[model samples]
Target: MDVPADDDPFEAQRERASNPMRRLFDEYGRERSGTFAVGVAASVFARVLDLLPPLMLGIAVDAIFLNESEFSLPLVPDRWLPTDPETQFWLVVGIVLFSFLGGAVLHWFRNWGWNRFAQYVQHAIRTDTYDAMQRLNMTFFADKQTGEMMSVLSNDVNRLERFLNDGLNSAFRLGVMVVGIAALLFWMNWQLAIVALLPVPLIALFTYQFVKTIQPKYADVRSTVGQVNSRLENNLGGIQVIKTSNTESYEADRVEEVSGDYFDANWGAIETRIKFFPGLRVLAGLGFALTFTIGGLWVFRGEGPWLFTGTLRPGEFVTFILYSQRFIWPMAQFGQIINMYQRAYASAARVFGLMDEDAGIEERPDAAELVVDDGRVDYDDVTFGYGDETILDGVSFTAEGGDTVALVGPTGAGKSTALKLLLRMYDVDDGAIRVDGQDVRDVTLASLRDTIGYVSQETFLFYGTVRENITYGAFEASDEDVVAAAKAAEAHEFVTNLPDGYDTMVGERGVKLSGGQRQRLAIARAMLRDPDILILDEATSDVDTETEMLIQRSLDRLTADRTTFVIAHRLSTVKDADQIVVLDDGEVVERGSHEDLLATDGLYASLWSVQAGEIDDLPAEFVERATDRGARAETDGATTDQ
Candidate 1:
């Protein structure tokens, strides 16, 4: 299982976008092409409203200055107005009210449209990313940490949300503000307009450099944050281990180290901002001073329009200043928006990388449903590995209908890997596994898995009631059926004694239950499934000897009429098995019936001797009882022989 290096070309291109804010817009572009159109329209309308205040000021100045040049409709004749000045004053008031109402309406529509688009895009991305996670294979989960996945689903998605809610629409509106103000200034007086904009290029240059310097820093901050989160998640999941080993201090130190790295990363980003933002503020101040100094002097000296007509009106200067302020505010926000976009881009790259992973096991286009009849399973020359080291080397085995075959091996001897291959958790590197004489690869994954019931050494129970955990596989099972399954697995007594009986909620991973209880519950779950093929991978290894006996009895009944594959270290558990295969170092060293393998003096004999010696080493009372049972069996055998 050499994890392949990611080589997506588009990943680099997406990483290099000048405005990660634009990427947010592009993500929106996926669902409805009309989102961008609506967004743009709303932004333009909002900007138009922003420009109205300046225009109103300019109009008011004209009304106050030249008596005959008062603000009035050019298409309307003066004779249509009332003779009194008071009547005309009311008309102007009505006009102002209408303008305010119009602005309010545009504001409502703009916010409504943009927010709707943002939510739609967020929903689409979340759904798509979740689906992509499901489609990925075990390899992806193996390589990726759980915390990093959580970060993508929570933090990264929230980053995108922030961009949509404010950053994207704000940037677009800012651009509109800049362009509209520039146009208005030019229309008023071209020379003054040029003077007002003289410092804009310098402002933009400063912002670009500031953002560029901080972008990589923000990426570092995000990475360090992810590392810190991973540490916390790992520690929390293994809290019991830490407590048992008295390693809380060690765990805390590790977490502190990661936290310190995060602090440094964030400080580095802040340092960049500390230097760049001060310079940006100074640049803005200089622009403001220039606007006031140059524009004021020009008006005071009666130049161009002022010199040709009269002194510059107070209202006009006020209006120009207001427009100038509007332009500058967006310039200040420009750096902040770029900062946000850069962080989002880094997050997006990680998220999309997960979404882009290719599943190692994929169904063929023409794959068919697995049809189970005789329950025959075959492993043909299977060679498999997790990485460079091989786990199963040209291994071959077959189990026919109604046969109980046991695989006994040392740790990491590829027993569980063989069973996983049958379930197609990972495809064999070089060989085929067949169910009912059909290649498992050619059968649909769902159908293949449905035919097999597996109970592993590690039992995973979700957070739910006892009844819910037992019926996890067969959800439609009636209460009576569930109880029957539990009885078969020897879990009924313990479950009935619980505080809530069937309704007792199992804590995370069934942590509240003892080891033996969890194993029994798992067996009960498998029994409910009632698959034709059963795999018990060290299922009773975690339980006490007393509990193991009960579980063994349940398993004996369950495997009586089915094909079973048992992987275990306890040799006594499989002495009655139809056949036993002894595996060591990725190859089968010996395999036969219990009595025959013992006579061979091979691996099985060596393992059986060790386990039998342990059993014989028990207390004298237990040994005497076993001897009495053996004598009784021999007496019965002699009578039958006669």
Candidate 2:
């Protein structure tokens, strides 16, 4: 089993970037430029149109109602306006109607464009992240949980979508309103505009503080989310085990602990966020209150307040109040926008961090496809390990074409590890493994693996109908061929008896099937694969003696003309093997046919004698050694199983 990494509550925080949003824009912005451009245009149009009614209202108040100001508009030529008051009233009504109608239409376009951009970008991010994650080596995956990776694809990716949809849209809309209102306010009266915008720096400072305070909290929330998901996934997957072990309360405690962590983290961010938004409104309200007090005095006295000298018309004061309030709302909303942006930033960092994670192995650009010629496999002085402990040392062996070579050893003897090297699950540390005189690493991984068939003690089946699982890798296998393969593996009887026969659904990981049944199905799948070379690592370890005999008969026939390697715990299973190489503590101690090894009477003979119920025939030194080895084997077996 692989060692698990310690849980880091600040794991996502470590990936914090200065500008992950910029990275997101760079990667996917070009792809969705069409929708993004349209969305931006619509936001500009709608927000600008929203300012029209206020502008027209101010003009109508002065020119039409009180006649305190001339009938003048900002951009229109004076000659274009009507000379009489009645025509000016009609013109204001028409402009207001157009503003409302045009704004509604643009709003629809805004929602459509932003929604499409968000959904498409979210889908692309998830797919790309999953692609990057799945291609990483087993070593990388060993320290990761499935639920943690899924959090990136699901929670983090969906968070980015929300930011793109609501956060980005709000940002554009508020930006237009703030700019448009400020410009209009300044144009109407620059002195009052200065007084109204007094709280701008304070708002900016408060927002910066809010962002700084909540950034780490959001990261903690994201990290805890992954932790909670991992716990749930692990518990749900092993529910059967938990029930069998009567650990319901134990599992519940674990769930509660992780969930509690998430709650605390999320609430911390929520607390900060709640305080920030209302605090911004108060700061914004300061500007609104200041504008009201000063503008009211200016309009009442017909003079600017507090040393300012200007004729303050009632309509201009009214326009300033309206524009200043709009500015306040946008300033307040900047808090909400920043909130979403921080959340999305943490998620983006995680998504990009996973994408940037390094892989353990890489294929050369010039790697060639492997073509089998007799499948002559060789291991010359091969050595490998995990971490610092050596699992295999100076191991050398060969299985020439059409030969049946058996690797027999106790548990943790590196038998399975040795076979994995052929598959390149882990590369050798010292020497070379070649097939047909070509180094396994020199060829493209796909072609090399495609030519080798492997069946191990632990069998895995995807959730699907029996037929689908059997034909998994060999998608083109005919019904006749599938039935033939099942029959050959002695699985046809059990399969036909299952409910719905070959069409029966196997639950996740094939939990619906028995151990022997799953093992047999695995054999049938390998038979359908029909590789030129085969590696069987304890393939029959789970089956009954009767089933093993039946499978052995089929295997005997299947390997007649193909190169084969077998690793078996039950030495009797490999008695007929052409060559039996005995491994003890990673070194090959005995090598010969069954009879030849027995005559030498070494570790192999001691093991054979003990298994054959001839314990008294062994010497004292060999007896103590055999007993110790047996104890070690059992201990190792239990460890491996766990």
Candidate 3:
């Protein structure tokens, strides 16, 4: 597995060590400030109200049944409010009921606030991440797998939502309960409160250790998830090949390998998590048991442990026991909070890291739209490479508006590289490509791409209706326009014969259609765009001879009065081209008309003679050179496989 240059999962631990919440809120939370504030306030108030029932129980135990009414409250005399035993009992009951009702109402508002916050943030982050991803340079995508990116957008983004909803909600609720109960215990009886709090440090230490151990494991979990997803996606995408090669068992074993890795990684994290929560429970149970033993001794045995006297009251003891019991979950939930945070922390690094990657290709700030009266394209001293290996060096050419310029070359001779440079798919390492005398780099990307139409050797069609795929780039095209373009590309007859005509669904990558049919649809798409400059890269290679003749006629009319650059291996396709440019080793070796190149009896002449099935008529050296070139192509392919 090659890690993307933009992402390092091992460093996720270091990144997660930073404040993920702060980074997330800074990037995505500020805009929802008002909503978030409301949600937090609601959670706080709800938790506070929830604590009232327990306190009311203590009040009832002390005042109504014991006939003591010993607790004090400011600004109210005992006689002013229910002083009779029966009235006092009913009053406490009413207050408890009211508190429950109030807590319920606040819980509803809290849920609304948090859910809305979570949903909005989820939608925003996913969309923003996708937008940022689409704007990145093609090289970034070339280095990263589609499934790996999808995992970030879908799984990783969903994880953030889970943390924001469940983790944050539980954290606030538990914090309020622990703090409010602690305060009440100390105020009631500081002597026993100290005993109750003895386990706090131990729990904290345990939780800290758990977090430290689990952080790296969670990061591994996230990485393994991406790998598993990548493997599944790769298998599905290449299912056709797998079936054709009868390698289903091999692919299944590959899937099992990645799936097992995911299972092992996830199980390790689960094992640590399982150990952590139970350990926390034991610590909490110990604290509860200790408080019960000492408090019970002070009351029952008439002796406080290492204290003045057994001054502990029955009512206060009940309150202490209830508060101690209540402390159990928050303590255990602390481990859960840490668990969710670590998972979210790992996910955030990959998501934000992708967002931080810079797009290498961008137009100048003051770039202007290209206005083309004539789509004259010029590639001047262009040089480019993938890393240190140059694909095209010092390559230059001119295609006057409306002229048909055919590019013919051997496999590694840079025909496709030159066209890609014209499209600005990559920036040239040296010199420039200009359209209508304006430097392409100085023009807005949208405008530069809008003027050129491309039909690739491998045509891609979306899984949609035929009409939709044809008008993908020109979405506003009416039925008449779509029909005209289809007719012009000689695709109308076969398309209308389909089960649903133009409305028929072309399955993924147009797998429902034959190769020739796909190519014709691609030609129709370019025709619909009506670009001033047209690029055809082996456009007719997939079609039969009759269909090729029909398409050639349509292309002849489509290329009229437009800047056309054609790349073809079949010499017949370029026979009528106004000028022919032959490339060898990334440099131009010949330039002339077809007949003139044939007259020169050079490389083009030998290739033309070979294509004409006149290999015996070619010179012995030319035949030897052709055979050597074929051998080199095979050797290069093998090297690439290695």
Candidate that scores best on TM-score: 3
Give the Å error, residue 45, model 2: 1.4
Relative to the true structure, candidate 2 has a C-alpha RMSD (angstroms) of 3.4
Give the Cα error of residue 373 in candidate 2, in Å.
0.9
- For model 2, the superposed segments whose C-alpha errors exceed 4 Å read 1-6, 9-19, 609-642
lDDT string, candidate 1, 107-182, tens digits: 6766776677777877777787788887777756766567766767777777877777677778888889989988
TM-score of 3: 0.93
Please give each candidate's TM-score. Answer: 0.86, 0.92, 0.93
lDDT of each: 0.76, 0.86, 0.84
Rank the models by lDDT, top first: 2, 3, 1
Better of 2 and 3 by lDDT: 2
Quote the positional error of residue 98 for candidate 1 in Å: 4.3
lDDT (tens digit, per residue) of candidate 3 on 570-632:
989998898999987778889989999989988788888878898788898777766787898
Misplaced by over 4 Å in model 3 are 1-20, 69-80, 308-310, 616-642
Ranking by TM-score: 3, 2, 1
Error of 3 at 41 (Å): 1.3
| Candidate 1 CA-lDDT value | 0.76
